[model samples]
Target: MDLLINHFWELTITGLAIGAVYALVALGYTMVYGVLRLINFAHSEVFMWGSFAAVWALMAVGAGKASGLGLAGYLVIGFVAAMTVSALIAMLLERVAYRPLRKRNSPPLIALISAIGASFALSELMGLRDKPLGWFNLENLRDYLGRPRENLPLPLQIQTKAVFPVFNYDVTNIDLIVLLSAIVMMVILDQFIRRSRLGRGIRAVAMDPEAAALMGINRDRVIRLTFLIGGIMAGAAAMMYLLKIGVTRYNAGFILGVKAFTAAVLGGIGNIRGALLGGFVLGVAENYGSALFGSQWKDVVAFLLLVVILLFRPTGLLGESLGKARA
Candidate 1:
């Protein structure tokens, strides 16, 4: 029983760490959905790009070398670079893919199709570029920007040679960093939406675009800002993801994006707080379910939870009709 309890706590911590990442990614999905009433399927790709960006940046800064300013410094530089690149890419994607569609006043179906196409195109680009990118060598920019050739070692290490503290819990430094960063980001986002002018614009547009425009809010600008914020969040998630699980490939975002999107729905689409809650719940549930039924059924468990939630509490735990209410 003691052994089981120990393992449970460890797994719980691991689950929360992962869940924090999911929550960050889910914020992008929920935010866009709330304001535009559209599911940005391509948001996952934004995350993928962010991860690649960080990997590349780390390599550029000689992160993998045995003698750099150490892992901590490398991580700081890598994260900032990755976030910047991801945000830019996300904004561009919005402009090229969704903005034009919105301008055309296209039907939601058409917009959805556009998102699918953009996702495929982006993924295919990564695939075609993957081979030339090389492995951990970091010679070319692609090598830096691409996924690792091999899987990163387990973030945790156990010390068998220690007499005093025999069982060392060596959680990955990156994981802790990622978890903390996510929390910081959430707080920043909360403040932005609650206290900033841009946030006010976002809320106003979310409530009623026509009214917002009537009040002199640039509807287009607000929409763009929404995409921008979402993109930045996705980028941050990407950095943590690569650090936690090193190998990156095209289409990586597809599965992750889907799960994050599910979380958004589970939390009641368009509710920021709901997204956070749903993400953590899903993460923990998935981890425990995998522990109980094996990894193969983990995804099945997540979907089952979604189904049960929708069937019973469609509005989610905290997602009431308060979407229109200012944060």
Candidate 2:
């Protein structure tokens, strides 16, 4: 309690920074659930892939020990690489995994199982990426694989300098960038859904698939678009995550992905704003709980918070459906 009170501002700012990543990842889960009524477990792998892509892209460009304009340029390359890779992988999941099942009119349970399978497959593919290179006698090029199951740190070295002070706690550039970037992305998505023509198609399908089809909204196209949007969000989350954490692994997304899902459920699974709120709430709660107890209890604190919240309001904080969101 004393620790939390003393460092409350610091915890809050840093927590919000971490929460920004969670919120961006949660957007993927929430948006897909809003449209398809199915959880895409493989979405986590999409995030992991993006992180790897970002790292690989930076490494390819020899981005290291950069500062000022050079650092900014490297970041742009990372974001572009991560977003592009995540988007393609997301679209591919829809085409190769979920689309076939949807065509067959598979039960939701079956689709879920497929999602889980796809998640494992993607994770393993990254884990074993060096195996193919080894088989082809490309030992010199396999350094990037870095022992598969181990941690892969970013090549760039980012220094954290405090930008301002809040209640005696300094807010660093990373914190501001993360929080602002997430808010901007969320606002763009919310506006896009509210005003765009394709957005209406998405809302129509979510509201009633049959009616949407009857009204000439292409159901297949809308579904693809949903996955694409989710993927893009996940990709952005990946870049932010790498910026904050500076390290990743083949299975890095597993735990974070679960937390993001909890955030989505906490905020109202289908509500875009709900995801944003839930993520910040969860992040703050985790920090406070850790301060009260210990660092090891952070995960426990987060899930416990979710359970307690759900017990009282199962519909979530802003449990409005995407289809029902106001323009």
On TM-score, the leading prediction is: 2
Model 2 reaches what TM-score against the true structure? 0.97
What's the number of clashes in each of the models? 2, 0
lDDT (tens digit, per residue) of candidate 1 on 1-327: 343355675566567777877888898888888778888888888888777777666655555543234656766766787678778877888899988989989999988888888888887776666555456554555433334333322222222221122144445544567678888988999889888998888888888888989999998888788888888888888877776666567777888899888888888788887788788888877887788777898899889999999889977756632246346
TM agreement with the true structure for every prediction: 0.86, 0.97
Compared with the true structure, the alpha-carbon lDDT of candidate 1 equals 0.75
- lDDT of model 1, residue 114: 84
Clashing residue pairs in candidate 2, if any?
none
The Cα error of candidate 1 at residue 69, in Å, is 6.8
Best by lDDT: 2
